[model samples]
Target: MTKSQKWVSFLILSMTCGVIYQVAYIRFVFLGPTARALDVSSQDYANIISVFGIVAMVMYFFGGWFADRLSPKFLVVTALAVTGIADLYLGTVPGYWGILAAHVVMAVAGMGLYWSALVKAIGMLGDSSEQGRLFGFLEGVRGVTSTVVGFVGTAVVAASVAEAAGVLWLIRLYGILCFVYAALVWLFVKGDDRRLAGLGSSTVTLRQLWRAARNRYTWLIGGTVMLMYCFYTTLGYFSPLLEHRYGMAAALVGVIGVVRTYVFQFVAGPAGGVVVDKVTRSTPRFLRWMFAGCALIALSFLVLPRDSAFKWVALALMFALCLLVFASRGVYWAQVGEAGIHPDERGGVIGLASGIAYLPDAFLPTLSAWWIGDPSATPAVPEQGGGYTALFLFLLAVALLGLGLTTLTDRTRRRELAARAAPAGAEAAPLAA
Candidate 1:
């Protein structure tokens, strides 16, 4: 295989293994804590996730900047090492706060790896024009990897129910897996020169970074991303939402999350890339299709009743909603490059878009928990969590806002294809260009 292929394969495996460590353990955190054998309240669980999100945002910014200034290989590999340590403690820690703190460490390490040279590394492997496809492949594989890990781990854990030590060992196994995970990422990247190997003395200043952040399309696309993730964010909690409303079991809910990953939605991610390629001949007008997707998604949310009688409807809603949202995310990032941001600034633009767009990760769960979270609502106090009414409304509003933002891009680049025809240094350059 080519060197770039080798690097990406390793990074993909690293990201998958690293993510599996967290995903497999998610049930054991403040919310589930199966190993501690404690059944924590959902709100408490949301709080821990919120904390991780907050710290993760910090890493997103710092990591992106670090990628520009330092070697991402070291940042990523070292962060992976730290994450392994955090995982080790997380599984073994008996205290609630200790586990929570460990999550913070894991978030920083994971986000650091996400930005640290990895994104840039992959971007370099493929031609600029093919970014949408590249991101699609990466994300598609990530979905597949996470799904496989969760399934295989579940099989092992489920089959070990007769023995208590088996369950503990399974959780501990996840930790040791991280060490092997770190070693693979290390071994593959041992002699890599992908980071800070060139670009001596040439980089955008923080001022340019600010301007990029301030760009109108930046806000538009970032908003698109936020809306997109607001939906992906729901995928995990969705099963619980089902269990709360319909009285489902862990086995069923697990099926829902897995189906959402491998079958329900993730398939749309790369499929969206193919759609974008087919329509790029029309340039920015392709965004209109995205806007249509958002509108339909919001309309469905609006149509979904807040009452429990429609719980099955909610499942169907997310099953369809995720497909649209993932499709939109895959294309929106590609549009950044399509809209003509400089190739040199690709990572920064992606970083800025990603950094700003993902802010919802920091707090949406709490908002969800606050809603449908009434103490007097149900007997399943910990499960009932909060207000579904307000949460769905919040999601609806964001989707509408995304629709508005998309139109602004549509209007601004009304003649994008014509503009693409203009030669370099041409005086009559397109305004959006």
Candidate 2:
């Protein structure tokens, strides 16, 4: 594809991937209202999140294998259709079990197909040099798409007679948009099948996939991605934190949640991309420094006050935290390219990495729900033990671990480069640590 065609495809693919999850995690975007609308408790709602994670955790592995064997166009289009239909079913105000089933369907369609396909397609769009910028742009575009839709959902809630009704309407809207994205992917994301097919054989064996899984770079990068994701997963709790701490109104909390979740993403994504690609010239080096900075910010959250007077201060810090999380997410996948995995192994490698990275999706929500005790409880209640504080402390630990893993990943990269540049039969020169 020409550069222009590649960019156009990139934009279309980004937007299409962006909107697919809108309804799947409505609970995170509009937590309180969703719980009330569905008549579920905080713990029960968390169970839904856990189930989605469990399904997705398994699908991620297969999704990568499927990416190697199938066309991106097929996976993306099918995922959208299935997700749209399932979401429309969810919009019907399905009972708890039905809602659970809907989530399962969406997870299968999304994690099992669209996600790995999208990652592989994006990797194929640019050479090793452009990995950071391409994934960064993908995140930026996705953030903008999600932000705009969030506002629309917020407006729908503001105009409706009841929160449940508004939420139902929002689900239907997302469901329709899925079909629209499917059409867009079909029309614009062209000519990728041959390019990707030529890279890997159709009959990729499990033994080869297992070998890819065993690569050290895969685990190092996967560990980094996994830790960053733990931070990312915990971010959803900020909505409830602000609401409970300050007694903010639901509408206000929803608006703040939208901003906290997505607004900074556009700035964070490209900025991270440029820094990694052009400035540091190494994704792992950039991430190592970024993780250290995030660790400090997570520490601050541990001591931050819950008083209403300090609410805005807390919000500012959360936004800063969001920026760091989004930036890390925008480029973590670029390490797949930087790690020098063979072209044929990229999809399987990403699958294994993603399986590891997204493992938090399975357990974090349930663990957070347990840690937080009850969202309905007051923040200062001594009996509750300040749930958010405990959560942030866990995040701080993740950041530190991520920093160490990233440092090691960078060292591995340096060794690889040095070895590649060495003459045949010559020893690679070692430098001081």
Clashes of 1: 8
The lDDT of model 2 is 0.81
lDDT of 2 by residue, 226-290 (tens): 99888788777878778887566778878877787778678787788888978888888888878
- By TM-score, the best candidate is 2
RMSD for each of the candidates: 5.1, 3.6
TM-score for every candidate vs. truth?
A: 0.78, 0.86
Please, what are the lDDT tens digits per residue for candidate 1 over residues 59-168?
Answer: 76676566666655566566667776776675564466876787788777777554455666555444557665666566766666666666655566556654233345
Which is the leading candidate under lDDT?
2
Stretches of candidate 2 exceeding 4 Å from the true structure: 1-13, 64-74, 116-138, 183-204, 380-386, 415-433
lDDT at position 272, candidate 1: 73
Residue 326 lDDT in model 2? 80
Off by over 4 Å in 1: 1-21, 24-40, 68-72, 120-136, 156-171, 190-204, 262-266, 279-313, 344-348, 374-386, 415-433
